[model samples]
Target chain A: MKWKLLFELFVVFFKIGPISFGGGYAMIPLIEREIIDKKKWIRSEEVSEVFAIAGTAPGAIAVNAAIFIGYRLAGFLGALAAMIGVLLPTTAIVMLLGSLYFLFKDNALVEGAFLGIRAAVVGLITYAGIKVARTSIIDKPTFILFFLILLSLLFLHLNPILAIFIGALAGILTMTAKKKIQQKREEKTHFQNKQIREISK
Target chain B: MILINLSLLFLFIGVISFGGGFAMIPVIEAEVTKRGWLTTSEYTDIIAVAGMAPGSIASNSATLVGYHVAGVPGAIVSSIAITFPSLILILLIAVSFNKINQSPLFHSIFYGLRPIVTGLILFAAIKFAISNGLIASTFSWQMVILLSIFALSLFVLLYYKAHPVLVILASGIVGAVIFS
Candidate 1:
């Protein structure tokens, strides 16, 4: 029974490789169908939770979600199975294209094509940055963090790894502080209400 | 060997890359470019090709970078190295999933971490724009042409919501016509 579950996890993620077109965001529906509807492995809400965690965790959403769902199902081996299933097909496809690129990269026409593609890449990455900002930069504080971190990268010569560390630290400190302040404000309001009742009495 | 270096680099990348594939770019650029394993232009090309493939663009690019540097063995090593950190981290987190579920502290950390990733990605885009000569130190006709392509691609992506592969291919054809 355990082995069967692992195998199923592998097969399912292998099938997921080709359909991940558009971007990682687009794969939510496909995962919903395979894991939630067809397999009944999880519920709709649970899938979103998984994707949320997947999105927050480091790595690609598809692979992270696969590992999460697989571990949820069958533990360690399930994770390995699902991750391999995800990477195998992707690696093969990349290698095939990689070989062709290496072979013709020196050709003038290919260089032109690559030049144009590089320009487009800048656009795509920027678009992706905007998409992330839409979600991550919800408040003024978050926007400030985004701005400061960006400036650090561009001017401060900050290591990207350090930026990630600092970012997580900032998130933890500020958000926790925000929650505490809100708690205090609520407490103050509650205390004032008690005073008003006593005075009236 | 260089292969070992490659593995160590990618493994580090897998750990630090919060958010997703785009989040991985600035780190990959820093390490890979420093090592001279790949050039900025080549890195951009890998991103484009990886986007066409299924799965994570980050991992796909790692595979391409590996192959570009060493050979088939390098590709295999990079694929494994890039993915290994994810497996370890997931296993650890999955075991403690219940604790993380209720931890407001954990949630807040991600809330903070994400915007940093956004900043990093924007940094990467700007860096690539400068490095790949889309925006150059000394302006030229080629720079103008590249900027136009960049503008057109960004416009189509944002306004029309066109598929990225089509945009890449369309840009390639435009490049072929103009440059070649």
Candidate 2:
């Protein structure tokens, strides 16, 4: 039974590996359908949460999502199974194509095909950006933060790692301040209620 | 020596690539060019190949570069190195996920991080568009065709909600017909 589950995990991700073109976010809906709708392995909400965690993790979003799902379903070995499965098809295809590309580097047909694919990739990236922004830029603070990071990256040419660090630090400070202000308001309301009670008495 | 360098470089790229595959391009280009493995034009070719090929562009580029520098072993090593850090980190996160998710600090960090990641992705898109000549200093029919393709792709993705693989396949066909 254990071996079967591991094999199942591998098969599921192997199926996803090839068709997951355009990048990691493109794989999310497919993963949702497979894991939630078809397999009944996890619920819809759980999948979204997994996507959130995957987005924040250090690797490719697809790989991270696969690992989280695999680990949840089985354990460490399952995660290993899923990771390899997800990577295997793409690796094989890339190796084969890489060799062929070197041999036919000057081919017009290949070059023309890439000319179109590259433009489509730009579209793919833009779509991904819009999808992420829809979920992420929900409030005034987040909207401003988005523009700030964008401008810094475009003009100042800040490192992405530094930007992430600044975002984290800024988040912590702003959230802490908001919490403190909320607490102060609660305390003031409590004191006012006590004074009103005493006067009535 | 090349193998060691490739592994270490990609491993570092993997750890620092918080925004995902597209965001890794600038760093990868800088390192690969600095190391003298591939020339600037060749590196651009690799990016194009990686984008066209199946898999993450980051991993695909690393594998190709590895193969170019060393051999099959280099490819395996680089690929493994690129993916290793994330596997370890994700496993740790998976194990302690409940604890992390429950923390207000974690929530706040993600709240800020999400928009930043979005910006990074947008930056990557714009960079790619300019480099690929989809956006150029002077306009041409090629630019018009590419823009139309981009618009069609975006429409199909957002409205029709077509699978990306299908979109890529269709775009390849469109290229073959128009450019060829």
Against the reference, the lDDT scores of all candidates come to 0.86, 0.81
- lDDT per residue for candidate 1 within B1-180, as digits (tens), equals 979988998898888777788888888878888888878767888888887777787888889889989999999999999888888887777677779878998888888898998999899999999988887779799999899999999999999999888998999899887888
Tens digits of lDDT, candidate 2, B1-180: 878898999898888767677667655765776778877457656766676676787888888889888978888888888988888888888778779989999888878877887888787777678878888999899999999988998899899987666776688778877897
lDDT: worst 10-residue window of model 1 chain B = B89-98
Q: Candidate 2 docking: what grade? A: medium
* All candidates: CA RMSD (Å): 2.3, 3.8
Q: What is the TM-score of chain A alone in each candidate?
A: 0.84, 0.73
The alpha-carbon deviation from the true structure for residue B165 of candidate 1, after best TM-score superposition, in angstroms, is 1.2
Candidate 2, residues A83-196, lDDT tens digits: the string is: 899988988888888888788766787677767877787787788789878988988888988899889887897776677678877778767987999999999999999999
Error of 2 at B93 (Å): 1.9
